[model samples]
Target: MNICRPYLAKLCSTLSGGPVVSGCRWVSNGPRFPFHSVKDIKNWDLDSDHQILPPPSTIFAPSKGRRTRHDNFLDFKRIRVTAGGGGDGSIAFSHSAVQPFGPPCGGNGGRGGNVYIMACKDITSLNGILNNYTAANGTMGSSNNMHGANGEDMVIRVPVGTLVRQVQAPIYASSTAAELGDDEGGVEAVGQDETENADEDEIDVEEQNEIYAEQMMRLLEKHFKFKTNYRPREDRARWLMERLPPKPYVPPPVLLDLTVHGEKHLIARGGRGGQGNPHFVTHEIKGPAICERGEKKEPVWLEFELKSIADAGLVGLPNAGKSTLLAAISNAHPKIAPYPFTTLNPYIGTIDYSDFWTMTLADIPGLVEGAHLNYGLGHQFLKHVERTKVLVYVVDLAGKEPWRDFEILQAELEAYKTGLTARPTLVVANKADLPRARSNMEEFQTKVQYPIVPISAKERRNITHLTGALRSIVEKAGAQG
Candidate 1:
């Protein structure tokens, strides 16, 4: 038997009531022929397969804890986006050797880049999306009345069934108010000496952090909600050049969405270029030198959610042979185990027919009793089947009350959506090879209202008949849709 070094020392200490540290050296050298007490263990002869004095190892070691790993399949993401800013207008005079003092020749500023969102059919999730996006800024204007080049536009490609919406931004580490808003999960203490020595103008740390957060919010709304191409005129002075977020900037709500493949939507537009000083060169103002500055853009928040698209969906309770049936019918190699909750993510597989026609079937994670109330990631599992044309309920015929499972499944779907139960569906009675399955099916037939098809997914029996039935149901459902 293999034993650890720590275990030997503890055992020796408990046996002879001596210092365990001294006996630790007993395990350092080979175990030769013994002629004395426990101290003679170091002198014992060692061999390749020593029975009593083998090599020390950790095979029987003790540990404080164990860590369980979970695979991640990202389907939702929150991002912060910012559009590009406009270029500044230059002020230069056309000078020459003969005519030292010439007319104004400054160029106008260029417009900033824009942000676009597109739906693509290839992608299935938002795992590759970044948490932040910022468009390029426009170049500055120069002499010879040449306008600055516009910034490059960016396109964000998402899954075809993605839903996007603008929302409140999270607390950033760089913000001064992060101390109050961040989830630090710790208690704070204030010393009397420090508070008494501080000035009255120095606000309390909490109050200061709150004020900083409010100021940061106001600043973002003032800069990010810049929809206009050019800056608006100020009320105080009509003649002077003004900037965006006019004196009293009021924050407005913003959001958007795109669903169809190749569908595009503009999240933010670039700023407009400033006018040159020559534009003001009139009869009254002979030589104007004033120019406007380029407008700046700020960051905003957006959330992206993805839903799986398929022609048919398989639904059942945990360990109801859904994954097995999918693997037998299609080429999908999903995780299969004797325990419950083996399949954590939704998998889609394609089935091919003799005539080269193909069909897609999605294997969704198992649903629990309280699936409609969001138990055990129920909401996520249920949403993946919403886009399917047909639903296939796989029931475990080996169970004592198999018919009750069908009723529970129907109730969950009905609770999730008003008219979901009315959709076209098929009942699959799996595990027909098991003993008592036939008798159970007979009892199940009396309770259930729909027709049940008995089959053994492990043995692949009745799979052909099942596929033929699914083909007609899918065709009809697709035509109606």
Candidate 2:
């Protein structure tokens, strides 16, 4: 009888739904068999010579795709986050019999909100950006010296391993076309004087260049200060100066781009609001009471990135009890089932040790053969493996030729990414409870080249051995690094 064939049906159930329960039967003197998930009650073959099979283990993924697969759990490419603009000061007027010309009724404007980047690892994608509030313009300053309200804040979350780059708006050299146009217009007005003014235009261009250079230098000095002894006051002053547009060459605008995994989000921040009328006071309206105008909002861009850090990955074909092992070892409770592919997604678990020590384990989806070629949902499963230092290849030992199964899995890994197979790998032969299991273990040891540890995820046998082995590998990798 094909030993691994009975478990295949159960694998389908696990992938789609939950665990399957099946009767277990073992025969002495025959090949040692472990758990299985066989459905038909009448097919049990309860004769004197027959044994029953356990329900099938769950499977993950319809299988196919090695190349890919992030934030709000919503995928967005870009979003505009506009910080509230500063309110403009108001100009108030007050005239009394005793005291004329009321003090300038102008009040300081409110500062705009500053964007920030916070790091979080649990976030896998940026899908949350779609549901977030769009940018809001700053409130205009009120009359009688009231500053305008600051804008509300917008916080964005991105997955780990993201890289944030400030994308600057393209710098356009002020075109000489303006001067040419002015010359042409002047020629239409005065043809003979046009040539003479050409020299004057050249002189004006040079003067403008000098002014631009000076303005740029002043802007830089006001905004950027790097010295051995830097004071906070000067730093704040510099910050304020930098936000103010440069005198001539508007400092090239900056656009923030956040790249998470392979996805990129360009254009993150929002626009600034217009200023109030308080600064427009003149000598003619000299009063003691009437106040100033409102403030303007500022829009800026920002980026978000994600970084994933894990020490080990518990990987295997679907229904190999990867999630069960994770649940047994860590606080994570991944869906468990009897059929194949029970887990559709990856679940992260933390393993705690003595003295406040701990490590992380990522239980990724199952990968069949040809995962590297993106066959059988392999690509999405493979990426999570990239960050892990060690790979725990979990295998169900009761199935037919578990050792051959291990080899096929290794081939798939090597095919998908060349260096993957070379990484430190541990072979875990699971389901060691049945009568025929011992013989299968012996056969596996003789056939396989790497170290193989036997355990039963259902019976909780030899789990400590696996944990110790994993910890040792993790510690060794750390020390080596």
Candidate 3:
């Protein structure tokens, strides 16, 4: 007579292919168990009247350790946009005492919203566009030939080197109870087969039932515990639920690059408004009641990728003191650390050689051995180097292998993109104050063929000389271009 006893009995009966309990209906194809498959348990929505209850749990819970703020130097982003639909046209007539049947005075509908992507110098990252963008719809036309208000246009601002590409939106497939019901029928069939060989399959049927029951309970308990611990809100919960196993695959297409600042590209065009009844009042027909509806807005997806632009680029392996040299010669304040890969993003600084002449220098994150293969923040860091006309290879003299490090840096650059080694290059031997650095510098000078500048970045030794050499090289490169 216990409420739980009835549910358990029903479950055993369904699994054993036995007759259902009197006055009991199947909630689904199988027994009405609180915990089923991981997918099923999360989506389970029991009726309020059902007495036999499931353990308190939620199907959706937010993922742990999700970043709340946008990354300041994010180079890539995928955004979805929904342009507003055009407003409907009105078919109202003028109601005045002067002329009873005056001219047909229906108004035309307003145009829909448009989406534009613009490149700007002030913005450095795609972090500002974290949320999906949407535009407002136009207002409906009014009486007396009054046109509807046009929808507002949305302008998206990206970095100067950003490339915008149009891509198709991702489609998510939903799983239904009917799909899971197949498993129930299979279990029932197995149970019926076991009954035919009662004695031989008795233990097998019991074991199978126990295994399924344990699996169902374990999945329910795991998710239920997570839901209780995280206690995520609706939005976060939904985000987590969507990311559950079997993620969707969406491949974006390649599109044109937007490199110049103040450049504008139309990503989505607004829908056209429909004409009012007055437009249909032609010579052949009088007072036509026909009116067209506004066109529907089309949604679009865009991919934004940023590539930093600079006249000069500083490249080196991790912990090679690139940031220190950048701070010494330019006004940029990149994070200086003794650790590897400390600088996660690129920093741009301008050096003023004269009142009218100034050059921009970009300090990118350090590269590693397999940088070309996307190892150690390689792709993002190396991408910024592509825009630089001159390259300065910063090497740590104190590390005892400046030559090998320089070779590796050059190899990575060449591997990622050709013609980088052919560009005007300078070798800067940093950390010259160290005891062994002076000895290493002597060896580096004898082996390297390019111009070598030895200076202790920490002590600011010979920094002026290094900057002068860089300015001269930049000028020569500019003149050649």
Candidate 4:
């Protein structure tokens, strides 16, 4: 009849080497029970070696004959651009019948091409622009003092809210070493000397020479390894890897903010064309056959990042019915599954209220604990919610701790940016059709001060009421803004 009696009997049975308990397992010759106590059996390790098993190969291994599809929703891109070089000036003399060798008639060189980036609403990502872009060179000047044609400018189109920044070119070490072949000849000459000395004192001189040669080789190898592999550490690859600021590092000031559509920013300017030889044919130096060369073009590296803009955003933890509610309320077809973090990217959907009013709702990827510190999807997609006027908090009523989920979500938003929690918020209790949902909802209401709207997104129950409530909140927020 005693509560402790059953547990004591089970423990005695396990110690006596009877049948193994359901929760605990046996390891060979290591310990009677691997776990520390009976309460810790739930977190027991069955593997004797205690090595963690990796994910299945079918899930992690790359498949043959399959190509990864290009992601069109990329928010950031780094590109290297080389502008065209200016054309060389022409040096020629006029050969006319009336006046042969007429005043230095050489034409001027053409200007190099310029690179420009413009923001447009039609584009949604930077995937359309290739990694490397080279502009066309200008046409060379001709005889008879004909002016050279100017190069056509290159215009790159990107999505609105794109920011462009110029980055410094990386410096690399020279591939040719100053003392490359010095050790080769010395080693060969030493070997020859050792062979000659071996005949004189076969045992003593041979062993000494071999040992000296081995020590010399080791010293040379270490010296060369340090010089070739370690020195001049700032290579192109390493420079690129460190281009972005690390976590907790404040971002550098933006060079250009392309928030407006059709806004253009000149990232790289073209070199100016040189003056023709005719310009130098002055009174001091008449008929001078000298023509200047065009200036050289400079290299440019640009970083582009896109931030999405929406009227409202749905924020919640993973598998909290955010995607389901979004799909039910709007025309957006975001991927929805029972697994966590199903939606990897932000999905914007338009919600129409009546014929005149409509609002855009962004369904961002789920946020976990430490999201403000850049954990689990991180602050990458969190910026997309900054411009939202109204915030929708989605919670699963059938979850183990529905109220705690709401608090964690709010804490993440506040930590990311202040005044985020002060925005007009709407609380949604999803999955209300579940059996335990009603009881959990009652507990959630007593703990939370905000009004909650209970709706079953899967069954499309109470959807109309939820829509009306969200529309009212959004409209008020817009008016206040």
- Give per-residue CA lDDT, model 2, range 254-371, as digits (tens): 4333333334332333333333333433464333222222222223333433223478888788888888889888888777889887776677789987666789888878888778
* Model 2, residue 253: C-alpha shift (Å): 11
lDDT of 3 by residue, 2-113 (tens): 3365655544454434565555533346433333554443343446653323344532244565332323658899887767777766666677799777676777779888
TM-score of each: 0.69, 0.55, 0.68, 0.66
Candidates 2 and 3, the one with greater lDDT: 3
Top TM-score: which candidate number? Answer: 1
**Pairing residues by index, what is the TM-score of model 4?**
0.66
lDDT of 1: 0.73
In candidate 3, which residue ranges exceed 4 Å CA deviation?
A: 1-71, 173-254
- Each model's total of backbone clashes: 6, 82, 0, 0
Which digits, one per residue and each the tens of the lDDT, describe model 1 over residues 196-255?
A: 567757767887555444444343333322223533223212233122334323236444
- Tell me the RMSD of model 1 versus the true structure: 12.9
Name every residue pair that clashes in candidate 3.
none
**lDDT values for all models:** 0.73, 0.57, 0.73, 0.72
Give the candidates in order of TM-score, highest first. 1, 3, 4, 2
